[model samples]
Target: KSKNPPFMQWTDEKIAALAPNDSTERRGRTLASSAKWNTIATNYEAIWGECKGSGSQPYLVQIKLSGPKYKCSCPVRKPPCKHVLGLFFLFAKSSAVFKYQAPTEALKNWLDQQSTSTVSSASKTLAPVLKTEEAIEQAKLAKQKRWAQRVQLMTSGMDELELWLTDLIRQGIANTDIQKASFWNQVAAKMVDAKLPRISTYLKETHLLIQQNQNWSEVVVARLGALYLWAESFKKRNLLSAEMQEELYQSLGKIIKKADILAQHPSSKDLWFVLGKKEGVDIEGRSFRKIWLQGQKTKQQALILDYAFGSMGYEQQYIVGDLLDGALVYYSKAYPQRAIFESFESAKIYEKTTLNTYKDLNSMLTSYGKALVQNPWLFSFPVGLSNLKAFVNDKKELQIKDVKDRIIPLSNLKEAIIWKILAISGGHSVSLFGEWSGLHFEPLSMLTEDGILSFT
Candidate 1:
């Protein structure tokens, strides 16, 4: 039985074409051809590590890719083990049509060589390779031209924006909002999305001035960049950058003033932003504008922003550098739904040295103190928040004492690491949920009484 429904368009020829042996362009084809590679192309299953003789299972494992790519759980870590070698040999020796296709560029080059170099000596002088010096010059010019165009295009939208932003700072934001609050907010949001940290300074000062002095002008003009992007999004929702799409949609929920519902809604399902993702060449093809969603939060529902590639729209499976800044994510699902995003690399670092291993009440309290810095809701579990006898910080993490192997509360320790990161990142400021909502494990907010009690 096949895991794939009867292949609607799958043909034996197609399956043969995806043969793994030809996928590589190793120079020693004849030598490799000698190996009897025995392989079967079926629906790819998971990569399972198997050890035939133990010791430490052989270094190699078979990995199923689509259908053709396979790894042999042999003594090598590389792919297509001897099993693949044998499979290729068997296929070539047999009458079956299975054969591998070389990658596009390699195949093209090989074809060109076959046409020219393999021709009778008479044609060698007919089409000589382009002169290396000439090729280099052409390549350089092409690169220079491409960069010039990119710089020109990316900065083209900022002309009016720079002047407008400067004006907003001079006049102030809060005061300008009197005419249109949404406009000003939009600009502020865009600047943040653009990774223009300094510009945000201007927006903040303008906001403060508006609040304190009520002075505003060019508010709408200043915010034009972000608003225009959003308006365009409303007009062509799918065309907007990934970061912009998330920001604008989430913005609808957070807008102090709601847009009329009559406006067409973005009818796409939620795409989970799994941290650390890599897409083939989109990030490479476009050098500017990346989509970026913000750092993890206490509330799970925080809006996401797309980063233009090169500008941060670059996607990866995990946020690699500066763990605190942003996450690597992409849409993983659809429909009005709960999208799952991971913070594995950034958040998983704390999994070691847990307070559960601590023997003293003082140390347990200390661990809770650390947890409070990253999260304010860790009042129980490994601390004594759930038990009646420990730390007095209004009920926090629960801890058990080893005395007589009895359960107990952790004493309140002041040195919590969670509190440290929170203070550094800007302490979580909202409750994130209803008092009685009963849900625990909300990553972005203060943990609740029941949450602490549950962990205990």
Candidate 2:
């Protein structure tokens, strides 16, 4: 067994941070046991290991600690795949298990290739190919043409949607067969075809509300009113301020590319705490993930949204409760929240003594109302509250009560989650973080004695 100290300082949480998703993290944990590896060795610069798999040949994995780069012979395309994470976990747990060995020729070749590729990529970036004046003008014209065409399609689609909404209101909400899928699906399909996926999502969610809620008549009316307002806003979008116009575009599902945001927006550097994460597949079968972060210094919140098509996974991985030392560039909006990382320097486990939270429910709601005033289309707003007790009200609904004894109902959450919260609080006050929709709160995570515990 090797007697040298571990080359890098890594903990189990740090290794978990490298996993792209919870599934990968669990797999890595399962493979962390020493018996899973056929061989494990380390040199001065790197760690290499081989693990047996279903295939005839064992999968080889290598980690270069300086760059923290990883290479695996497994078929997975994503870097730092489960095998690599497993090796990291092993080394982090017990480096003595790895035998000290000289660099093998194969390992040496891989290292040399990495160095050469790094230099080559840097040179290419430093000397990017510049387009000629004619090429630039042509590209500009092409982009303008595409935008004009898309605007025309969107206008027609919004017109159709407005007519549909008018007819629904004229025909009376009671007359419409809300349970029938085709009634909503037909219009939603048209919206998708019109390249207005965000409106399509709204329609689907309205349908779900009608199906799931007892007082859906009121909910449906409010939802449709918002949709109607959005359609009208689209018509007068040109007259709106630039920031409001950007908000409207985002609300309509127009994607602002990361490169564009990074190039245009100012970046804020801070020690950001990973608060919570939520992920699910939408009605369109596209998988989406949202990670929430709060800056320790600026106290600003940011939302990182990611989407993947069929069989594809998210590009980055983040573990809740970790601290990221980085800079983030936010998308343009009346009230900026969505952001993309401009630079990620380092990440580690957070060792904070206290959480930043609102004093009470009233204070949190006041802040939320202010945000809504800035961006009327805002749906869900993140909030954290301290000294709140969770319990079942007299109506048998799960709710949280603040220090002032004012209570707020929770959103429709799983029974398990509700019970877990109640159990954690034990009729006492606990700090909690979640999204507030002005109507109900949806708890995602809670700060406990140990650390932040995620519910989803």
Candidate 3:
């Protein structure tokens, strides 16, 4: 919003990037071609317009060409709205339509406010970094008070869960109606009320697991045991190391602020390879995508997780099989895998480094075991196995045999899928990267001299 000089010209691609999807872009393009405008004006720093929509009056639309901030009179939840998008498309496609003029009064007021706020914020940010001793003490006291409240809530929740588990154990999970959704919902609701929504989610998932499996009692008991361990550990959290404490807080669903993370954590710059990516939606319906990268020099794996809500676009950069030079700020965790880009230097579709792979399944398991020792919360870890031959076993199950002839029966993989990897390998031992559960390896991609073949 600050009136900086126009850094770059707006293009069709840039307009498309602001749009949520191709459909939105198409609609905007169509509207741009036909929409009637009362006034279209622009300066170097911003553009403003009054466009006739399907309404009585024209909608006033203004966009700061610097931050690309949009303000429109239309009542659309999406920033910029369709009207603004149309305006952008018009500006990008043909700018001569806009008259060279000074900004309107409303646009001028907004720009002036933005400039004042930017100057004030700059002055504040340039102030001293350290707080006074008295201020520090007050902040520490407030933090302690908040933590104490959280601990009390968790304790209450744990007590209720302990009693519920006891009742189930005595009644027997087989006797209990695990298929009854209300039964789990009641307990999950209690957990939510106690401010432990993540635990509620775990309980709901456990109910589904019991219903899906034939051995419902075993699954129930095992999950209940894990819950008990978490509860007991929470009671003795003071004895745990700092890293374990951070892990415990994460497991409890405590949110970590991104600002704090970037401020406190160390950053590293390296040439990173885009290994793989996964996309999923959370319970709240927020769409998220996670891209995994491994550094060539540091040999460190970093995860870039991004989120978007309705009508918002995901990140377009960081394509798989590309190498990028960037400084990444890691989140404080036992494994330290998740990170955000602090600074990106350069990126290109280049693949030069050799993929690190284990010689055998035992070696892979050993590495996972070591990682688990440092971070017990890790349920799935990535591994690249070398010299792996894919074949069908006697039971018609797809299996991957390593250099030592040790076979690992693959799960979450079908015949046609294994055939693709086999076809890529041509019966030769190739480097395969995948996630390892305790039972099987879920191959994500296979690396060969030709290129990276994604199986996920």
Model 1 whole-model lDDT (C-alpha atoms): 0.32
C-alpha RMSD by candidate, in order: 22.0, 4.1, 8.0
lDDT of 2 by residue, 56-75 (tens): 99999998754366889998
Q: At residue 71, give the lDDT of candidate 2.
A: 82
Per-residue lDDT for 48 in model 3?
Answer: 81
Candidate 1 off by > 4 Å: 1-131, 152-159, 176-456
| Model 3 poorest 10 in a row by lDDT | 117-126
Q: Measured by TM-score, how close is model 2 to the native structure?
A: 0.85
For lDDT, candidate 2 versus 3, the one ahead is 2
Model 3 Cα lDDT, one tens digit per residue, 142-260: 99999889889988998898888888778776665435877888998999888777788878877776665565666677677877777777778899898898887787778776656
TM-score of each candidate structure, all chains considered together:
0.22, 0.85, 0.66
Ranking of predictions according to lDDT: 2, 3, 1
* Alpha-carbon lDDT, every model: 0.32, 0.80, 0.73
Candidate 3 error regions (>4 Å): 1-139, 166-178, 207-225, 348-351, 392-398, 404-419
